[model samples]
Target: NKGIGGFMMIKNFKASEKIGDIVARFPKAAEVFKIYNIDFCCGGDRPLSQAIEEQKLNQKEILERLEEQYGTLRSMELEDVDFRKLSMTELIDHILNTHHVFVKTELPRISDLITKILRVHSVEHGQTLSQVHKLFGSLRMEMEQHLIKEEEILFPKIKEYEQNPSDQLLAEIISVMEETENEHDGAGDLIKSLRTVTNDFNAPSNSCASFVLTYKRLEEFESDLFQHIHLENNILFPRIKA
Candidate 1:
């Protein structure tokens, strides 16, 4: 994060630009918006100007913070390539290779951690940990099947559409993307439920290392899942046959 005076000059933001578009472009803004309880996910269609006014927020401060946070990225020599600019084929490949692989790898590891923590700490944190484990199990199962569906059905059709674009194929892409987005929402809802139950990733004072580690890993998993969904929902899906 940079100082307000060190913030970048953002001339591209339009008055009518929605909050989701802002987060999709400047992800750091998501944190600032979250501070104000602004929804940049499901109910993110409202314009920034309107949201600020309605919530009695300081528009200038929000803009300054967003620019400051985004400025840090500008200040750094980052190797991160923007997935949105890639060709449809390239983007789909990157999603499968990057985000999908990460979810698969991290999900199982965290699942194991949660299970162990629940068993060991069952006497102390059993109720909450148990709920977290069950919710996470459901989420993991959903994601496992979700990735398979994308790999076997969605990505192949997207690739086929890339080779031969047509109105019918475009409709199919839209339909599949819609279904995929819904599943993403379901997974997101489950994570939110877990977060609520866990007091936003705070570990109990008497928590063991495993307990702390499980909460930390769960938070990391939630962050990755959000970024994954944002990439597909905000960027890739919109480019289909555009």
Candidate 2:
């Protein structure tokens, strides 16, 4: 049974389950799905095994990592908490201060780098440069709107519920959060596409230092996003779940 859960991890999602359903039940799968450019939200109704095979990924390696990371995923204690039990205002403040700040600061830098690289190499990598631009624009717009929606609508309602917990308010906030999560899925898709268009951000063998630095920065940005999303999706939202 060692491989049952690992293999089954990819196997079950193929049985008419949508991407969001799989991701909702197995959040860790997001990390894997992101790696493969699978649309686990909007275009989520596909076989996991087929997706993997079509991408030519090594299933053994994926299964091994899945087993290592989430072999006992079912028994994991992921519980909802009363946001009232904690400081909702402070949590919102933290998300804005840290994550929003990161987004604002890093996005322009990535955009500048994309423009720079395209200026230098677009003639040689025209299609990739075009994709990079498209991905960057999509991500920037999506994330900006997402943060606005969360801060203006969802977070405020969540805070209100903290002070005055009500079923009606909680229901509305949950609905909003679920929508935000789907947007997160799309943002995740943009990042995956960006990496692909950048050739995994591999600078040419003869690339200058600026090219190397840009790739490093992009890599760091993606890593930070993974952590940022994890905290929001796994910790913050769960705390507010009724």
Pairs that clash in candidate 1: none
RMSD of 1: 16.3
In terms of TM-score, the best-performing candidate is 1
TM-score against native, each model: 0.66, 0.61
- Highest-lDDT candidate: 1
User: Which tens-of-lDDT digit does each residue in 73-136 have in candidate 1?
Assistant: 4333134666666898877755654466457657777899998988888997889988998999
**Which residue window of length 10 is worst by lDDT in model 2?**
1-10
Error of 1 at 204 (Å): 0.6
lDDT (Cα, 0-100) at 114 in candidate 1: 91
lDDT of 2: 0.68
Give per-residue CA lDDT, model 2, range 91-139, as digits (tens): 5655554456456657777789878887888777767777877788889
